[model samples]
Target: MGNHTEVTEFILVSFNGQPQMQIVFLLLFLLMYTITLVGNAGMILITSCDSQLNTPMYYFLKNLSFLDICYSSVITPKAMVSFATGDMAISYNGCATQMFFFSLFGTTEAFFLAVMAYDRFIAVCSPLLYHTIMSKKRCMCLVCISYFFGCVNCCTQTGFTFSLAFCGPTHVNHFFCDVPAVMKASCSDTFVNEMVLLVVCGLIIVTTAIIVLVSYIYIVTTILHIPSGKGRHKAFSTCTSHLMAVSLFFGTVFFMYAQPGAMSSPNQGKVVSIFYTVVIPMLNPIIYSLRNKEVKEALIRQLKRKGFETIMDNCSTASEFILVGFRDLPELQVTFFITFLVLYITTVMGNGGMIAVISADSQLHTPMYYFLKNLSFLDLCYSSAIAPKALVNFFEEKNIISYEGCVAQLMLFTIFVTTEGFLLAVMAYDRFMAICYPLLYPTKMSKKSCNRLVATSYACGCINGVIQTSVSFHLRFCNLSKINHFFCDVPAVMNAATTYTYLNEAVMFSLCNVIIAITTVVIFTSYTYILSTILKIQSAEGRRKAFSTCASHITAVTIFYGTVFFIYAQPAAMSSPAQSKIVSVFYTLVIPMLNPLIYSLRNKDVKAALKRTLGKKRLFSMNR
Candidate 1:
């Protein structure tokens, strides 16, 4: 800060280190932020959903989780941007706003933790009076008081800190606009401001810290007098998490603000600031989750309800498999993560857009769009089965999958892939009927028959998936099994087996041949007759129209078949694991991305349907 007329903004100088350190910290910050959000959000969800967590502890805990989210959000995101972009200037009002909310949430969290300590004190020290003392109305009032004090504490510190006259633009030495950093940057006399900040911070910290200390003291004293050791441990365990959380929050706030003058230099302050701001918020939920038996049981109950019961049902590692994905190519892992992330997003959006267009436009309710919708669904499932896991594995050190997870991934991927093949064959037959026998097309390919054909396609794929997964998973494997690809593939999984897998291999290979041959026969026969019929058309436009309909499907089929045949049918080339993994990615991820684009660009009906859908929206909006 200088002797200027008016200060406009502040430049944050924290985290502006060497490029290498910035990158490291950036990744760490991102991972911490993600955990903070997911963990806090999960605690919120568990408390809200689970009846077991209906006590005063969880009620305040839910609010504390939401407060942690708001607290971390106030600073971490902007710091992440500063790390990424290197433009760390924040406007004057923005700085004040950041200070206000950050202080508010921070102070509120302190008070909430204090309240939680008191709740545990009552639960353990006065079990009979717990309900009467911590009733709903009283709990609400306590929370409101926490917020009210948070507001007052924030206003006193933030207002007094900013009220000091700064002669020049402020340059904050920290990632965020903290009171200490702002005071350091001020040109005016900050003695009164610093005294006020320290005094205010001391009162809040001492007040809340005393509540936590006294509560735990009473809790421990009560537990010590219990006749049974188990009872003593059970009672103390309930306060353990709250005690740890209080130590972390109050310890940091006291260190940063309760000191007489500046606590430390800018660099040390920045490093310490990260703990309370980013790390503690993320750690609290995890600590609670691990320590609290009820929270764990509730999490398991929730998971089981969501269909993970199958995974949770088995405890053995007999079916576990590790995915060996991009482990050897360490240098290119980041590049691959970015590339596949983009491809996955594109695949989902493209296929989803096709489905939306088909459903919205009544003109697309014909047999072609119906089949197209099914194809898009298959493609979407295909990519989702592989890409999400594979993308995550790119950055992870050990790409482990449970036996149930591997089985499910392989099962779903097989189902989607096989169904697409059969669906494409059915699509060829639909095109053949449309071109070869236009008069009989609608009657022969009636709604009932079309439904039967699609269902039959799924039935074929499901049967094959069951057979494939059953055979592939049965073969014995090494103690530590590793599948040599991004996601599970039949060939990759089979190759990892330690036992005799000839029968498994034979069955898998034969099924692949049978699927390819059966679909190939249908598609080839239909397209052959349709080709002859199209050649005989008298008009060029008529021929072009017929070819356009089949072009997209043919392109999709050829690419998919070529990929499948190369990866699975030809076992000789499987020795080169790298090449096989590459093809597996193309087969699974790239095809989905291409399918919707192929249809939307090549088929007149899809484009027209999309346009009509958009035009309807525009007109509807104009009318409104």
Candidate 2:
């Protein structure tokens, strides 16, 4: 077992060695492959042909759908061939090639999901900058970057796998040329390759996970400030699908790759691979796309329009169909103005009231309270950045936001939002200390310590904001000012830049690595300590209370970290637009909605406060 028996050509043990099973396997895989093609192709078609889907988010989705097609094709066809013909023999080169591309695309999808999460963070947490931050050019760059990285990863693994001598027995235990199976075939010492895979795969999983976790920390913290239940619900709805996707995708992938072959059986590996390679791909379209109201509506509208044109015998061009046009609606003026007034009131009332409450309540004068105050301030800034422009769009009908306005909005919004993430994570640690190690909570998170934590969060956020904004804005914008989304996103803005962005990307990637790494360590360490302390609690009642408080936070953290880590950590070539859009919904809409529910449902104090507030509001309104 030390050196694999000279594996010249590997015989894949197809789904089953039985003839009937082979036929069934062929039918099943063919059906799956067909579905994969149809689903991915349909997503691309719907996204591309529909004018409603021209936005950066949809643009990302289109790339993801295309990737899905490519990813599935890499394995499904080979599987189908084996099932159909009973030829389990893959050439040495064929096996290596298959393994390389399989790893590349699979890894690429992981990053793509992470990018989508960041997109969501910007969209939900910094709505004003969504357009600027996630511009067309930036989106294109991200997609290209994702693919490039995937290629690089493929080259490394493929080159290494091929480099090894495979003169041993040709039978590959699994269906395809998986890393472990390929290694098993190698006659030479494959210990190096195995170690390399272990290190690389572990880093990829861990790094991407950190990014997603950090992003969600901010996402959840920001969402907690919302006063309205409906608003919270809306946010949660957007994020839950993403959370599910992250859990499914990462759980399976990490289980497959993170565990060394020695520890996990080949059967276990096969089961795990099936999740990422087949089941996850099939689930992604449904999990991310179908769950999205905008995507669904767009699909339905596209279908209806196609049907209507066929029935009428008159082909109306796709350009003529308006999904979100503000034209020819005079009543929109009144509606716009009212919408603006309401948002303005909400921004002032919700954010300002939260600030006032935290400030006035002496009982809340702790490290955690300070973080909450910062959160309130962030919410105010975040809301202010977007709501005004939105109000204007509703009334003006044209919805034309200027270049300078977009840039300014994006920069400030990033500052606040990034700051919010660090702040919330800091708060989580503070809470963890309070709940886990109650005796040391005051000393550990003292006033001075609290100030330091707040300042550190601001420092991290500001630095990230400044670097991103400076580099992002430094790029000369092309005349393609028609931003698809309402806000400026990082990718969108970069994509629109007229100048070369290689240097900017280098800087961006570097910064992402550093900040994401730091936050990951901090959050992971904090959670570890918290978990340790929670387990040590002598009383079950104490443990339950502690876990309840931490559970909601952990859930929020899991969603955020999972998304961000997956997206930015990958090499640029693998960043697909379709994947980005899917992940984006989680951080943006889903997290905001989840935070309120998590907090209210978990903490009786918060629920009581809310009920009291609502009761008072009702009495006052009735009296009036």
Candidate 3:
């Protein structure tokens, strides 16, 4: 056992790309993995739980489904994490274990497909002897035989691959620890490893494939020989699902491993490998259930029972919700992921930068900048409450949020947004004092008074958020699970209610209208007096200066209210779900990113403060 392996770990260059594209791939792979889990698990559950599916075919089918789950699970979760974080390092033993298990499951799936084909052949070719010939004892033996061969093939291949000498480089140039990729990384002679790969992998693949082909051929002949057209169709239909699954699994396996160097390129190998490893598992359950009539009926019955239980409890009080996010525009999911990811990053950085800038600079320690800092903090919280989960949900087909999660998100979003609105009104008043009563502006907008105003905004916001969240959750959601919009908006959450939502709707409108009504009155009154005072200024320069200070606040308030009003002011049913989502996106994602930009770019004081801070840093460095 002269194992002189110098490399302790290998980098699994999985899904390498730009950061945005990596997120897109993460979402893509994550969705496939989730489907693989649910679909295969459902197949196993249905086959095990249902009494009608007691035959040899279904016995092998569930085993194959379990193997599919294993096959996908072996590599997908690690690959997805790598896709998200760009950390692809796998330790030496970890790589060996991954290779062993993946190979075991993959080889087992091959044998299981062939075994299923044999079962199909027995039913179609020797119809009367189907049960007695493929009995419970024999079926168990056949499944055991598949596992035995899989273990043997995988052990020999993995042993040979890991027994190689010192590796030249630790990079495996592939997503997972496949034999060829690992062998190529070795500095030692890989002739034996290649031989083992070729001989062992070839034997298992060719053997199983031959069994499937021969079984299908005999079954086809038997079906063709049937006198009646209906008999022929019935026999052929039984094998269709198995044939499809076998073809998908074997076709990808052959393209990747059978014809050595047939990969043509690394990228080609990866794409082909994905079909078998990631995509095929997700497809198998679909192929089996949809094509087989018995399985479909069993699934329906199972669902009806489960649905009855779920709806009974959930209609009274929802346990969870399925967020239907941009499902209509499925093609643009990649674009949306990339776009929203960029927007979220920008929002966090922009708002975060404003907070840091205001906190760091003494020149920015005024009543106006103090309120600006609070606004930045509010926007940051608002964006965070919705965007991270929304961005991740873009990857999910069924974006599920727990009932408690929905309540928490709704409350947090409400608090931040409500507080921001009230704060905008406060800022307008500060602007009014600056322009109209310049001498007493300092006293009127004093630190103590500014703190009180901001505190009052938060107090009002918290009360609104709590009342809204509590009422929304209390309403019975009935059987509804698919929420039309992303995140738990009050309107969307309210629409999901099964019972009379009149009280919820009234409380909702009452709180929103009151918040809007007071904030709007304050904003309008302050701006009206500010405008009057500005117009009374004698010089053109004086008018411009007065308007300059108010412009950014005006922009922020307008953008915030326009979308907020569009979403919350109208009845939930009156608002189109799509229109509401788009408007919500503006206020939740785009506005937070834009607000910091608006205030920082438009206000000269902020610019001067930033310059002074940077100059101090330069002076300090020069002194050092």
By lDDT, the best candidate is 1
Error of 3 at 519 (Å): 33
- Return the TM-score for each candidate structure: 0.53, 0.48, 0.53
Residues 1-624 of candidate 3 have per-residue lDDT tens digits of 365466788898765633323533553566567658867887899899888897788899899999999978899988877875689899888899999999999998889998998999899888899999999999999999999998998899888888887553578878899877877777778887777777777888889988998998898888889999998888888988887888888888887777778534777888788788888998898788755779766754565555422223434446888888788999988888898899999989998889988999988898889999999999999999998998889888679998889889999999999889888988887887788888987866778778767887786688578768866776557443678888899988877765445546775776677678768876897899899998899999989988989989999999999888878876763358888888788888999999999999877888888898889899999999
Q: Candidate 3: lDDT of 9? A: 86
Q: Per-residue lDDT of 1-624 in model 1, one digit per residue for the tens?
A: 334338888898886653323433553576568768867997999999988898899999999999999989999999888876779899888888999999999999999999999899889988999999999999999999999999998898888877777755568889999989988888878888877887888899889989988988898789889999998888888888888888888888887888863456778788789999998998888778755778867765665566544322333345578888878888999999998999999999999999999988888888888999999999999899988888888767789888788889999999989888888988988898888888977777778777867887786688678768866876556545888888888888887875445546666776787678767866897799989998999999999988887898889889989988887776675678899888877878888999999888867777788888889899999999
Q: What is the lDDT of candidate 3?
A: 0.82
| lDDT of all predictions | 0.83, 0.66, 0.82
Which residue segments of model 2 deviate by more than 4 Å? 1-8, 16-20, 261-264, 307-624
In candidate 1, stretches whose alpha carbon ends up further than 4 angstroms from where it belongs are: 1-5, 17-20, 261-264, 304-624
Q: What does the lDDT read for residue 601 in candidate 3? A: 83
TM-score, candidate 3, is 0.53
Which has the higher lDDT value, candidate number 2 or candidate number 3? 3
Candidate 1 lDDT at 129 equals 92
Which of 2 and 3 is the better model by TM-score? 3
